[model samples]
Target: MSNRGETVNIAIFTNSYLPFSGGVPTSIKTFKNAAEKLGHTVIVFAPSYPGHKSNGKGVIRIPSVKAMTYAGFYLPVPFSTEITKAFRRYDFDIVHVQHPYLLGETGMKMARKYNIPLVFTYHTMYEQYLHYLPVAESIANPVMRKFTTSFCNHSDLVIAPSEHVKEFLSKRNIETSIKVVPTGIELRPYRKKFRKGSIKRKHRIPQASKLLIYAGRITPEKNLKFLVKCMAKIAKKDPDVMCMLIGKSAEKDHYEYDLKDIVKREGMEDRIMFIGDVPHDKLIDYYKEADLFLFASKTETQGLVILEAMAAGTPVIAVDAPAISEFINGKNGFTVPQNMLKFTAKALSMLRDKKRMKQMSSNALKTAKKHSAENMAKKLIAEFRKVKPTQDEYENMRSLKDLSEIDWSDVIKKIMR
Candidate 1:
């Protein structure tokens, strides 16, 4: 640890970052900003893919020799041990691992070798990932659960984004100390533009058209096909009703193309538009312009978009899952059953009802102001300080794993000192 009295230096390991706008990437971005604000230095180690560009703010981009995307999911082909070697040299105070993938695994090994306290944040539900791997759920879910549980077990502290995730891990004996820190959003940017803004005109969206928007990756797990299916019905009911999807396709450009083809086939092409990717600063515009926010995915561990949309003053129409329900309620948005037709009907019903629609928008903005990234970062820093080893605990972390190998009296004296 640096002699710089309580100043923290965190090395964050994540599979993806900006140029990628899903739950995990966004969380890192916000957390980094918050940490810096709290007088801490944060360095992010993430995958360097096609759209990823380094901002040069202590974040190091480790490029993948090869990377591929399928159906909007990005997979970085496992690469060199150069990262692990460098991490040992950095000697960071804490190593926080975001995902349980290749980068995280390498970081974990480095943490053990270097005697650094390791913390893990549980993000996605990989058990639901079996279907995407082209494996049967019966065979895939157990394997995925095992992998995730083992990853959590290795950490000194496990930070779960929700109570449900905490419960899931505890049921399986991930006995590490756990903290339920709901992911926080930075509200200043979104809340400042509470009323309608120039985002509609900037996107060539006509004033009379009621814009329905979905701002996320165009992936199967996201269940975007249902939104395309509903666009036809929404268009029939209100010709002025326009559905716009503003998100980038990671490795899943083909699936995105298929959806575009669906629009052309349904003759609903002109009614829907796709804006592949945009800068983080500009994303608030889409959220600001939407009359209603729609997310159909039940696969998310926590639907950050639902909170983001509500923060941007747009009401959400989401599936009734724990992740969705945790932040939203009847006062702020509508929750529909997971069935396609029901989802579509609920989305349309919310959009068409002007009085109820306006009220939800108000409730959404109020709810969103509370989830700022600054607040979340503050909470995380507090937790890191709490879980960090005391003089005695540090001795244990620095000692060999085998209890029999240590000089007990000398070690305890050093710890007491």
Candidate 2:
């Protein structure tokens, strides 16, 4: 580690970054900004996006190709000489990687080559998102687990956003020192004041109508179809209830079309509104205007969006999943099984109780306070200090596996042909 009181140089590697708006990018930005405030020198290494200008500060965007399977996401062009030389020049004290995909492997090689301590953050539950790929579900899940286990095992330490994620790594037999680090949010934005009736009036929603908001990308893993189905039941019982989805999908033509079809087929078009992606600064206003926030996704590592809603003083109604269960409960928010009947009933009950909603809103604000960015940065700095590079450890060729031994040539030929 650096001499006492000296700032440690950190290089964070990821498949995506700015000009892209999603959970991963948001997490990187949050941690990067917070870490810098604590006097740490940090730089981001991410894939370059076409037609977007990257501010040449502490970030390096490497050349990559747009992935065919996933929209607006790029896969780094393998074996980039520029990437290899860039790492050699920076000589980062620690290499932090967000995912265990292609760029991540390069990070591992560089870390080992320089004898730098490496850390991996388990950000997403890849098994739950096999539908996004063209591969067969049965084949993809086991491959994902195997790949994740290998990548995590090679790291000096692993960071899990919540205990739930740590437990998942444990279950998968990821033999690495794991730390629970919840990605903290900047609480200042949520604390700001916004025009009270702006969102409602802009959409022309009824003043008395109970506005239930869902904020995030519209995707299959988000279980938006289920939410729409539940809303259909709630609308029948209370016609004044309005469910507004406040984000757009990366593949808007695909996911958005499917969701709109559900709304029309159920004959609840007027009650369900797709208010496409609002500006991040204005997101707090949407949350503040909402009566209750609803999330059905079970694949979140920490559900940062739920915490953002809580910070905006909105109670949530979510599916009973690990990350969300950490803060959401009877006092702050409600969690129900994935059953449509039970979820619809609980949502309707919460909407009907004005006194209970007020109580839950107060509780949510308290919960949000416990997850400040300052606290998260301090915890991360402590972990960074603990990770010392062992002398002569990298010289042990047995501990570090050679990429050549894996029959990649044969596998690539068979798969590509």
Relative to the unseen true structure, what is the C-alpha lDDT of residue 1 in candidate 1, on a scale of 0 to 100? 46
- lDDT per residue (tens digit) for residues 1-417 in model 2: 676567888988898887676888888888888888888878888888999885457888888776655567776644677666777677578888998766786777678788888899999998887776556789778777777787788788899999999998899777789999998887878767688878889899887778889999888889999998888888888988898998868668888898999999999999999998787788889999999899999999999999889988899999989888997978999999999999999999988899999999999998888887767877876787788553444445452344333332333333333
- Please provide TM-scores, in order, for all candidate models, with all chains considered together: 0.83, 0.91
Q: Per-model C-alpha lDDT, please?
A: 0.73, 0.82
The whole-model C-alpha lDDT of candidate 1 against the native structure comes to 0.73
Show where candidate 1 strays beyond 4 Å. Answer: 1-5, 50-53, 69-91, 130-141, 191-197, 250-253, 388-417
Residue by residue across 159-257, what tens digits does model 1's lDDT show? 988877787778987878999877787776764543464766766768888888888877777777777877767776678888888887744447788
Model 2, C-alpha of 258: deviation from truth (Å): 2.6
Clashing pairs counted in every model: 7, 0
How many clashing residue pairs, candidate 2?
Answer: 0
Candidate 2: deviation at residue 32, Å? 0.8
